[model samples]
Target: MSGEVADPKPGKAQRRRLSRSLVIIALSIIAGYLIIQFVGQIDWGQVYRSFGHVSWWQVLILVGVLVLRQTLNAVPLATFVPGLGLNHSLQNDVAANVAGTVTPPPGDVVVRIAMFNSWNVNPVDGMAGVTMNMLNFYAVRLLAPVVGLVLFTVAGLERHRVGWALLCALGAVVLMLILAMVLRAEDWADRLGRGAALQAQRFKASADPDKWSAAVNKFREQMSDGFTQRSTISMLALLAMVAVDSMILLLALRFVGVPASALSIVLVIGTFFSAYPLTAMPLFGFGVLDAVLTAAFVEESGLHYEPIIIAGLAIWRAITILGPLLAGAVTILVWRRRSGSNLNLWGSKDTAPTLSEA
Candidate 1:
C-alpha cells in the first residue's frame, strides 16, 4: 500500500482545469488577433508624438483621478451590504471584477459569494447587495443618454444625433419606470415575474410561473426596506462614479492634445455614453469598444485629430480597463494569502463555494 503507484491519467478536476484553460486560451487568442488587426491600421508615430508634451504632473493628476474613480465605483457595494466596510468592499469588488473579466457567466457571482463567506457575511445578503448595485448602476447608465440629449439639444448640436439619443432616452425612461414599480410594490414585482415566466413557458415548458413569482416576491421583500430608504444616496454615488469615469476619458483626450476647439466636453461625454453600453461585452469590450470610441472621435473632430483621438483612447483604456484588471489580480493574490486558500474562480470543491448554496 505504501508503494502504490498513482494513476497516469488525469482526474476529473484536472480535466476541468484543462478545459477551462483551453477556453481562456482560445478567447485570449481571438481577442489578441482582433486587437492586433485594429492596431495595425493606426499611425504609431502620431500617437507617440501626441504623448510627447504630456507633463509628468499631468500624468500624476490623471493617476489621482483614476484612484478617485475606483473609490467611487466601490461605494455602492459598501452602501448595499450591511457590516461590510469600505476597505473590505473595495477588495471584494475588485476581486469580483477580476472574475467577471476573465470567465463569463456565473464566475463573478460565485467569486462574490465566496468572498462574502470568507468575510463571514451572509450569502443571501451578498447576492441581494450585488443585485441592487448592478440595478442601480444600469439605471444610471441607461438614464445618462437622456441627460446627454438634453445638453446636446440645449447646445443646438446635430439634429441627427438627437433622434438616436431620444430613442435611447425613451428606452431608459421606460426601464426606470418599470424598475421603480417593481421596487415600490411587491405585487407589481410578483405579477411581472409571473408574466415573464408564463411568456417563457410558451417557448420552454419547464418554466414555472409560481416559482418565478415567489422568487421575485422574495427578492423584493429582501431589498424593499433597504432600497427604499437608501435609493437616493446609492443612485447619487453611482452617478458620481459615472461622472468621474467620463472625466477620466475627457482628461485623457485633453492631455493628448485634443483641444476643446476640436471636440467639446459635451461631444466627448456624448461619445462616451453611446459607447458605454459596449463595456458590458467580454474583456470590457476591449478592442471593439475602443475602436468605436476612436472612430466616433475621429468622426466628430475630423481626420486631423485622429491620431490624438487614438492616443487619448489608449490612455483612457489603460487607466479604466487595464488598471482595474491588474489591480484586481493583485487583490485576488492578497485575498488568497489572507484567507489561506486559493480562491479558485472555477469554484473547486475544496477551495471555492458551490453555486447551489448561493
Candidate 2:
C-alpha cells in the first residue's frame, strides 16, 4: 500500500451536503445573472438622482416604520407558541428571517428549532407553531390580490384585471377549505396526508404513506387548539405587517419624487398588493419582482418615471432585507448570553425534537 492511504469514499450525509452546495451555487449564479441584466436595463444615473431627493428626516421616519413592521411580524409566532413571550418570539423571528434570507429552506427551520430548544420549548410544539404561522401567512397573501382588485375597481382604474384576481381568490378558497377539512376531521387529515405522500413518492421513492398519515394526524392535534383560539390574532398581525409593508413602498415612491400625477397612491397600493404573492419566490422574488414592479409603474406612469420607480423600490428592498439582518445579529448575541450556552445552528445536543421524532 502507498505511504498515504487513499481517502475513504464520502458517506451518504457528505454526498447530500455536496449536492446541496452545488444546487445553491447554481442558483446563486442564476440570480446574479438576473440581477446584472436588470441593472443594465435601468438608468442608474437618474435613479441615483432620485435617491438624492430623500431627506434625512424622511429616512428616519421610514426606519421607525420598519421597526414597527418587524415588531408586528413577531406577534403571530408569539400567539401560536404557548409560553413564548414577544421578546423571545422577536428573537426567533428575526434570526429565522436572517437565515431564510441567506440560506435556503431548512436553514430557517434549523434556526427556529434551535432557538426553541434553547428556550426550553417542546420541539413538537415549536414545529406546530411555525407551521401554523406559515399557513396563515400564505393564506393572507393569496387573498391580497382580491383586496387589490377591489381597490382597483373602487378607484375606477381598470376592470380588465378582474379575471386574474378571481383565479387567485378561488385558489385561496380551495386552500382554506382543505385546511379546514384537515383540522376538523382526523380521517380527512389522514387521507390528505397519504395523498400528499403518494404525490411525493413520484419524486422520492421512499415516501411512506402510513408515516405521512400519522404525521398529519399529529400535526392536526397539535395545532387545533391554537388554531381555533389564536388564529384570528395571527391573521390580523399578518395583515398589519402587509399594510405596513405597502405603506413603506408608498412612502419610498413619494420620497423619491414620484408624484401622484405620475402614479396615484391607489394604483400604487393595488399593484404592490397584487405583486405581494411573488414574495413566496426565492430571495423574496428579488430581481424578478423588482423588475415587474418597475415595469408596471413605468407602464402606468409613463417611462419617464422608471428611474424614480427603481430608486423607490431599492429603498423598500434595502430596509426590509437589512433591518432584519441587523436586528437578527443582536438577537442572536442576546440569545447566546441569556442561554449561557453555545447552541449549534445545525442540531445541537439540546436541540428540540425534529419532525421525524414527532
Off by over 4 Å in 2: 1-41, 103-105, 226-229, 346-358
lDDT per residue (tens digit) for residues 92-188 in model 1: 8888888876754466777788788888887777787888888777767766666666667777777235566666667767876787788779889
Worst 10 residues of 1 by lDDT: 347-356
Stretches of model 1 off by over 4 angstroms after superposition: 1-42, 52-56, 195-210, 347-351, 354-358
Itemize residue pairs with steric clashes in candidate 2: none
TM for every model, in the order presented, reads 0.79, 0.85
Per-model C-alpha lDDT, please?
A: 0.75, 0.80
Model 1 residue 341 distance off true place after TM-score fit, in angstroms:
3.2
**Most lDDT-accurate candidate:** 2
- Candidate 2 residue lDDT tens string, 35-106: 545544667799899989999999998989998898888898889888888888888889888766555446
Clash pairs (backbone) in predicted model 1? none
Give residue 23's error in model 2 in angstroms: 8.3
